[model samples]
Target: MAVTRRQMLAGSGAAIVLSGAVDRLFAGTAEAAQAGGRSGYGPLVPDPAGVLDLPRGFRYTILSREGEPLRSGEGPVPSHFDGMAAFRSDGGRVRLVRNHENRVTAKYRVPAIERVTYDPQGLGGCTALEVTSGGRVLSERVAIAGTAVNCAGGPTPWGAWLTCEETEDRAGTNGYTRDHGFIFEVDPRGRRTDPEPLTAMGRFQHEAIAVDPRTGTVYETEDAFDKPFGLFYRFLPKRPRGGFGTLQAGGRLEALRVPGVPDLSAIQEPGTVFEHVEWVKVPDPLAAQTPVRLQDFGKGGITHAQKLEGCYWGGDRVYFVSSFARSRDGSAADHFGQVWSYEPSRRRLTLHVVFGPDTDVQAPGDSPDNICLAPQGGLMLCEDGDGAQHVFGVTRRGTVYPMARNRQNIGTDQAPAWGEFAGVTFSPDGRTMFVNVYEPGTTFAITGPW
Candidate 1:
């Protein structure tokens, strides 16, 4: 990634400029690498600051917090910071584009900026932050607005952020003027990306996306919590380039189907491989009446799973997360969580890991949402299950360990509540790790000895 400068800086003022830098592992950068080995930097130490408990030598600095007035006066930093990505910016700075997963009913929304605002009536969007390697946030602004449920997303090889909306609400619902549930491209370099939703991508309760740099083909997941659950999808674009606005040219939307496997949750064992997977075209990408997942796709309906979330492209393959599944919740099977990787070259998908029913919900191996690959070694998972929230690290040997815990108590002193961690990413240099606490919606830049 080249270091690019901002064309036009926007914001009320500069960031709070926190001190120090903390590092460990995050997805999508060489410095951060795919993952680490066993005994990852030792055990976790309780944080004295009562924000995030980190492993010994690691420290976190809050770059942007909810309810705090952004330097750009963009409505007190819209809350529910979800999925995010980091880029190499000009002058040794790391540019972050974060998603605010607010709904139309929320009080604070990503302020409607002139060119970047999509639908002023909607309440979810993304914000860009320019921060130095030392954890100093220099400038911030609204990268895109007017979208709903800006959830987890992936970074494009062409150096851009793909923000997904986790909603199927139409313009008539919730007083919205535009249809929800689509992916919006964002440029972190202060470049104005078209606010138009990439409708070519099938819409359904969207979760996250991962793009194959080799083919510019995008793999997407749906987080539908309904009776039939959601299906995994891939978009073959008309234009196969990583360049900005390339996805707007329209594409063919399809769902993955395994011969005998109809539901992904049925696969219980790790290392279980599905070969010769077929892609079934979706009848309705617009979801005008029947959702993409509901559309009929021939003999055996397309494959579906429960709570499919975080996604990232790493090691010549695409990895995704299934937060959790329960038969009581209408799933085919039950498990705490599952991580799977797909190899495009071989057209194969493998169950990399599956959390068993006996797994501890609060443990590092529990339910994982947003995920990132560590260039140096192991994969990082953002905790999203019961008990205390944490950022878990998985070693190359398949061992799971806690890397960071949410210490910020959101509830009363009698009963503390910590928000789940989201958007685990690292700068190009891998000197810093960027993540967010979903509740109270604070973005942290942690730097330490990797």
Candidate 2:
């Protein structure tokens, strides 16, 4: 396949021009619908099957679901689908490396394949799928297995997925054979998957990561709740651009430290910039005794944010999310969500967007997580909040609209059940947009007139 603009952007760490995505994020409900009260492909029409609701001229294909047998003959597809990425394959097919956020007690654990299991007693991992540009599933298999809480992660410029563990389960706990919260690399092609945890990267409740393709400097996020809230981190690898196993070579893991700021949520305004940011070395990346967040950072303490999630590389900066924050949850401030961008060159961190605390929970664009730059233009954010679930879109004009909704009522007439939309991404060919519903695990390939 020919190299596309997205590929080039990934290779060079080109900056993503958000085109006012930040401004639109917290836009008032009145201004949000300024563009005919809809943008992109227009308002979403309800899905007839009661699955995924999409805009007119758009449709979705359920590629796989929980409890289904894999086309590759591996065991059933694992439950709790989360983060995902698409890679160009040899033929016209696209490769997907999807994560399953199964806990230690999950009923449907990811099955081992090609002898690539991380820990026998662990219950979470990732699966690989090969599909056509039109959303046909050609094959499915386990890419990595026996890890735990494989939540959201980011894609690599070298064409791979960095699956993160959102737990810090220690050895001997709940039948765990080894320490559980480190990042692992998975090659969707089923070649070069390193079963060993990238130990140099600190062990913690890792939510996501973004690799600067140019320098291989990894920006990581810890999603722990306040018992010492999570900190933003980076792993400076020894061998920068080396493909799969390069992370095993070792690197330095450090947490972000914004001079006078200890809690990031205190900043309520967008465009709040902190300059000359520093990184403190993690005392114990393995966290043998004390968790990384609990470790001492001395006089200049590290910066912390609640629910740090969804990481991606745009242009020369690394963008990440704080799913949501509440003062009642011990946060310094409260807000619906926040998106931050860090510039290595400037050694600066800026609050790019801040969702309103009053955003209608049942409406579009609340608690955005697992974000991605939509191939067509603008940004796509998965809704992980109360009320109805939707995949919200921000058009170039800074108008926010509901691009898709989860109409799957897994509950009942009185208590309708639904899952948060996650892992929103597009194929290299940009023909389909793939996303996951967390509960009852499902993957959907949404195609529409972009």
Candidate 3:
């Protein structure tokens, strides 16, 4: 593909320029989008693109897929699985709340659950699956209501799931329910609210969410396209009390702008963050009702700054991965296609690790879609890209390893390729891990060691 820097900028109104030889290599029209730009990061060392390549001891098993029948007896549900969360309700069994980012028109059937309902046009719909540590499905149910393109969201302290919609267009409009472009909470027990969009969470194209247990502060990301692109936001609960209801009280919304970066507003740089750090509060929270401009960093470009997709809270910091817009050339190129850590306690954010091989600056840096920390003190990343996709692991010291290959490569044409692996998490005991493929629309379990 001839993905040139100029064409990339012109095609998308997002103005920001990428630097380095990597930019020149992708300086054509066709190749720019496919190559997540360039950074020092390269592909995995053993490069397990077509096969499931993990460390010495790890194995993956398919738990569910687009047309697979679950124990619930419901017809084979369609695919489009995105983010997921794992909870241990029984001693040996765990409950997984998985998001299905599908529009109403291209909707998938949920497993048997007479009580559950969804907008014909895919508004909001997530599934609750019961699985064993050995990777067997015990049962599956549809949870959440009236939301579409349920992207990625964070798990709550009280054991609830926050599901996000990646589109501003509502259901019925574009064949999707007008339900929301907001955040909704789902209880594992299958209880749901009246389908409320935590307006406090800001609107735009909602992506992943993370919370500060210390302050009950909720941080969110905007996944919009076009002029505004998107911005990261935080919702401070009205009361000190934190729970699903806390979101209704509303709080604050802030966008990121670093002081050191130059103004690349008109260039369309894919992924870049400003050098200096500063947070600006959105003056009007309701402004999200309509598409609005959040920030104009002038020239620096959006980098560690927030292409904001997935997020999880652990240790003393908040870890988030930018889905796209990583710089391949210039000073900021080193940060493209990487994982970043933000210290909530210290109020500082730093690049925790980089993906890919060393020496070559033009290879693929991982497009980590969604992420979760393992009970073993490590991280699991759902890598999304043009080539074969897979699940990967990142150690505290910054070592990257493979966990599983998305098996959606099998079967008929509509089975879908593992284009974007979003949701990922391990059982609380660290025994079983779950992954979702947003494109092929499936979820699976990974058991064993790495």
Candidate 4:
């Protein structure tokens, strides 16, 4: 059965507060649109290109594609483009740094340079591309290479990309010369750079990170799917103002702890809130044989969530995603997905949105992955769930609306080849939104009323 947003909220025991707010927000919008005979961008229109379907007055342009030659002539653009960010450059141009989530054994990879690569055999890294305000690609080239599983990462306040590896494979294991899981900083301008891993940051299956611009604290999420679920972590740099260099110098790694609440999975209902949460220092940030989450669990240091993914900092709160959680792996119960908001000032974590178990991907509560704060307000979530993938717009009041849909067709096959939509971001000026299709890898620049 398809689980509607209203149904999920009704079932939530303590989520009535959030549910009331959400109902009022949606009611106002729906009522206003009914009076005018149109609501929320006026529904998605089918695209003639058979790629992306957007609403009226919205169009998309293909900027850079996988398997194509790089502008530097080193090699073809790698596949599996994941997390990405855009920075404003001189002359109204935008520089985008994107992660390529390839593996060492993958067929395609960004070429490894002398000092720009950590491991020559490592097959995952990042690339930099320049685009104009008019949505034209100027150049695309390898920015960093020789890393493993370059998944989703956050942009630094100082204008650099923090590319994270989503694996914990050791150096000597699997023909890799260096460690697999760590964060590397990449300069978006293609200037002199060093592709060294920040060992101070713990080694684990890192999914994404969000940096607090005020204190320079880094909040990280893990994407572990095992008996012991992943944890939410924070890294406090020694010299917070020095940016990435301060992180390399070493800092304190800690996990989140909700005082009396040992198991976070118990609060699965939408609008469940936990106040006065604290951070417990991690005993070892660079654990080898034992994972950090397991070690922290032993000491009863923090709570755990299943498949924690995309995270972003917005409106003085850290918003993150727990792709899904189930009791099978020691979780409290089963849920399709969840969105959490951590307010540093209030020292509390609130369950902002909860998705019930439903197979309908077009519904309000599908599994969400890479997320970015919208220029106007709320968030832009990239759907990584079953069925056709879509880009969903989530309002601050918890109303969800489809922004775009993937309609890529396989060769000679009329049936839709549903690929995950990732790396959803917007231009600094908010004029253009960028997103990627995981399979056959394509990056797009979308323009609309938003």
Cα deviation at 154, candidate 4, in Å, is 0.3
Q: How far off is residue 127 in model 3, in Å?
A: 0.4
Worst ten in a row by lDDT for model 4: 27-36
Of candidates 3 and 2, the better by lDDT = 2
What C-alpha RMSD separates each model from the true structure? Answer: 9.2, 7.9, 9.8, 5.3
Top candidate when judged by lDDT against the true structure = 2
Where model 4 places Cα greater than 4 Å from the true spot, the runs are 1-39, 296-299, 358-362, 410-416
* lDDT of each candidate versus the true structure: 0.79, 0.81, 0.58, 0.77
lDDT of 2 by residue, 1-450 (tens): 343332233223222223223643332122323332235556567566878877778888999999999887888888999999989997779899999999866878998654899888888999999998777898899899989999988888888799999999887988888889999999989888989989998899999998887899999999976648999999999998868798899999999999988888898777788888999999999998899998998998788899999888877788889988889988888877888888899998888777765433222346788888765556788988765677877655555666777888778888776798889998887668899999878999988666
* Residue-level error in angstroms, candidate 4, position 270: 2.8
Query: What lDDT tens digits, residue by residue, belong to model 3 across residues 1-450?
Result: 345332232222222222221211111122212111111122322424443433334456767777666556655655677888888878688998988776655545444244544454454467788887677788886676456777788788878888887876744477554545777878876765435567777666788888787877777766643433466566767764686566677776766554554322222332333243666666655553445344332454432233557766665656565555534322233333544555555555454334333321222225567877665544567766654565655443333444554444544555544466768887877667777767666676766532
Candidate 3 — which residues are off by over 4 angstroms?
1-56, 73-75, 104-120, 176-179, 192-194, 225-227, 260-277, 294-306, 326-335, 353-365, 410-418
Q: Write the per-residue lDDT of candidate 4 for residues 294-316, one digit (tens) a residue.
A: 78444446788888998887657
- Tens digits of per-residue lDDT for model 1, 308-406: 998887757777878899999988888888777777888898886667665443334357899887656666779876557777676554556667778
**Residue 320: error of model 4 in Å?**
1.0
User: How many residue-pair clashes does candidate 1 contain?
Assistant: 23
Identify the runs in model 2 with alpha carbons over 4 angstroms from their true place.
Answer: 1-38, 358-364
